[model samples]
Target chain A: MKVIVNGEPRELPDGASVADAVASVTTAGSGVAAAVNDEVVRRSAWEATPLRDADRLEVLTAVQGG
Target chain B: MERSASGVEHEPQEDMDSLVIAGEEVGSRLIMGTGGAPSMQVLREALTASGTELTTVAMRRVDPSARGSVLDVLNECGIRVLPNTAGCFTAGEAVLTAKLAREALGTNWVKLEVIADEHTLLPDPIELVDAAEQLVDDGFVVLPYTNDDPVLARRLEQIGCAAVMPLGSPIGSGLGIRNPHNIELIVERAGVPVILDAGVGTASDAALAMELGCDAVLLATAVTRARHPARMAAAMRHAVEGGRLARLAGRIPKRRYAQASSPFDGIATSQ
Candidate 1:
């Protein structure tokens, strides 16, 4: 399945959880957040939350700003 | 102010005062933002010199190649972080950004900023109100960056914002408090703390914000972009404390004519 991760399209295996999408990016243990289709998925639910095709997933963390 | 039986005048314990927002008491009146700094080392020095107990950081996409975390810097300094929803233009965007920040930073306090356009970087009053209401309902402590408009400030407060942070001018403009009367009016009527955020160019601006009765002053570019970030930060620290003290001391009223300091009856010259 194709999903947009952080504005970049990536191909992940079907039935991929948010954790998989997040793992496709950096593998930081802490200070990471996941959002699927503009809705936040709590850290505990990442493994349980499944992502389908064309899902907009945003993985964000703190940067120097605001 | 009071006088002891021995006639020694004593002033209020202004130094020990606290700036309270949503039941959180912050000892320092200066809140620093980690933007436009040359490096993390400089920011660390500035944050230390500014004496800010609480600071702000923005949330962005995680970079695989990114090195060093601002969170680590804050943690090393022992300063609490307040994540902000910057670069979001709509209520939904701000709310989602805020939620992401809460997830990433583990703090419910957010600096809600919804810019209307890129030209002036002004807050969209309509979008800001909507976002504040939503965030407040979602159990987040909202501190909105708004215009120096008293009416809008009041509206944000009525929407249950923890604090109304009115800009002195445009962000990073260094114009200082463009309308001090408006700030005064907002400070006068606001039930929550009024934080003077953005448009601060130097130490004097921070001091003036305090003197204008603001509970605290928040800035980034002013100190970060200065020739000497740490020095300016120290100056700001002193300015905020001094300004708060002046506000508590109460200045004398202005008069049309100057009164002679020495009474005529006490004049020694009889010419």
Candidate 2:
């Protein structure tokens, strides 16, 4: 299945969860929050939340700004 | 000057008041921003010099190969982090950003900025109020960045915003206090803390904001983009203190005629 992660398209195995998609881009224990299709997926549900084909995922963290 | 036994002059410490917002007492009235600094090292020094207890950071997509550490610098300095929704355009976007910030930073406090357009970067009052109401109901401490409108400020306060931050001018424009009367009106009517955010170009601008009865001032470009970040930060600290003190001291009324310093009868005749 193909999913867009942080505006970049990538191929992921079928039945891949949001946690799996997150792990493919960032190391474990990195401070980040994920949202699938504009809906925030809580940290606890990341492992259980499954991603479908063409799903838009946005993984964000804190950065310097006002 | 009062001299000590060792011949050193000891200055008495003035009684300084704390700024309380949403039950949190912050000793420093200057809320600094972490944007536009040349580097993290410079930001650390600037934050230290500013003596700000709370500094703002924006949420963005995580870069796997990112190197510098803003959180580390903030942690080492013991400054509290305030996550802001800088680029969000609508209520939904702002709410999502706030949620992400809460999850990432472990804080329910957010600086809500729902900008209307790219050129002005002003807040859309309709969407902003909607977002504030939603966030407040969701158990988040919402500090909205709004226009200098007293009605809107009161509306946000009515909706249970912890504080209302009205822009002095456009974001990053450095045009300080374009509508002081409007700011005064907001401060007069707002039940909650009124923070003067954005449009601060120099130390005097920060001071003037305080003198206008603002509980605090939030600025990024004025300090971070200055030629000397640390010095400007220190100046801003002093300006806030000075302005607050002056406001508390009660400024004299403006008069058309000059008041004579010397007694009229005490003048020596030049006969």
Candidate 3:
């Protein structure tokens, strides 16, 4: 399956979950949050939520800003 | 009684009045932004010097290769973080950003910013009001960064914003308060705390904002980009305190003619 991760196109396994997509992009101990199709998917639900083709996943974390 | 090294007697320090927002009391009236610092270490020091109990951060896509510890620095200083939606242009975008920030930062407080354009980075009043309504409905304590307009501030407050943050000018413009009257109007009408956000060029600007009846002042670039970040932060702390004191002390009314300090009966004759 193909999905858009952080505005970039990426290939993922057919049954890839939000957790898998997040794991591919970030390392352990990194504090991050994810949203699928503009709706937030809680950290606990990442492993259970499945992504479909062309699904947009926005993985974000805190950064210095005003 | 405590005496200084120079043998000057010092008055007892009074407890600072707390700034209450959304039922929470923060110790400092100055809210510092985490942006514009050269590094996390510098930001940590500045945050300490400024004595801000609440600071701001923004949420963005996590970069795989990115390496910095803003969160760690904030945690180390025990400063609470208020996430912002800086680049969001629409209500939907701002709401989503706030949600994401809540999930990531584990806080329901959001500094909702919906910029209209890139150049000025001004808030779209329509969009901002819509977003504030939505966020409040969603049970988030929304602190909107709005323009220095009394009507807009009232609208936002009527929609149940925890606080109304009116910008002194455009974001990072360093122009200071452009319309003191508008700010005063907002302060007069707003039931919630009025925070002067943005357009603070220096310590004096921060002080003036407080003197104009703002409950608090929020700034980032003025201190972070200063030649000495830590020193500037300390100066801002004092400025906020001084301004609040002056405002509470009741300044004399402005007059066209000068009032003589000495009594008329005590005048000395030259002849």
Candidate 4:
């Protein structure tokens, strides 16, 4: 299945979770947030939460900005 | 008598005028924004030199190829991160970004910035107000970045915002405070802290913001973009303290006619 992570399409195995999508990017333990289709999925729920095809997953972290 | 670093004697005012926002006391009044720094190493030095306890960081998509995180530098410096919604344009977008930041940073404090356009990077008053109200309702400590409008500041305050941050000018413009009168007006009426948010080009500008009665000044470009970021940061630290001290020690009123220091009665007869 294909899932969108941070505006880029990536192919992931079936039954992939939000955690899997985030792992595909960076391995930051904390200071990372994931949202599926615009609704925030908390870190504790990332592993429990699952994603579907074409799901827009946004993984955000703090950067140097104001 | 306690003395500040500048050698000015200060009466021991209780707490030494700590900046308290939403029940949290930040030691320094110089609130920094982590932007425009040449490198992470430079940023670390500048932040430490500024002596800012609280700093702003923006939330964006995680870059897989990126190196060290800004959060790590902040963590190492022991500065509290105040997440900001920098590029959002609408109330909804700002609200979502605030929530994301809260979740990411594990803090409910947000620097609510709803920009109207990219050219000016000015806050859209309507969107900013709406987002502030929503974030306040969501139990987030909202510090809104708004135009230099007293009415808007009042409105944001009435809606339970933690502080009202009005721009000295546009963001990163290096123009300094364009309308000191409006800033003074906002300061006069504000119940919460009035942080002069942007357009601080140098130390004097930061000092003037404090002298104008602003509770604090939030700036980044002025320091981060300087040839020597750490030096400018130190200058800003002094400027804020100097300005605050000057405010405390009220300035004499301006007069049309010059007054002689020596009295005429004391003057000796001259032949």
TM-score of each: 0.96, 0.94, 0.94, 0.96
Question: What is the Å distance of residue B145 in model 3 from its true position?
Answer: 0.3
Docking class of 1: high
Candidate 2 lDDT, tens digit per residue, A29-60? Answer: 75589999988898899999999999999999
TM accuracy, model 2: 0.94
B159-221 per-residue lDDT for model 2 (tens digits): 999999999999999999999999999999988999999999999999999999999999999
True-contact fraction for model 2?
0.85
Instruction: Judging by lDDT against the true structure, name the best candidate.
Output: 4
Pick the winner on DockQ between candidates 1 and 3: 1
User: What is the CAPRI rating of model 4's predicted complex?
Assistant: high
How many clashes would you count in candidate 2?
A: 0
Which CAPRI level is candidate 2?
A: high
Off by over 4 Å in 3: A28-30, B1-16, B267-270
DockQ for model 3 equals 0.84
Per-residue lDDT of candidate 1, residues A8-49 (tens digit): 999999999999999988888989999999999999999999
Q: Pick the candidate with the highest DockQ.
A: 4
Candidate 4: stretches off by over 4 Å: B1-10
Q: Against the native chain B, what TM-score does each candidate's chain B reach?
A: 0.95, 0.94, 0.94, 0.95
Candidate 3 per-residue C-alpha lDDT over B147-251 given as tens digits, one digit per residue, 9 for 90 to 100? 998999999999999999999999988999999999999998889999999999999999998899999999999999999999999999999999988887678
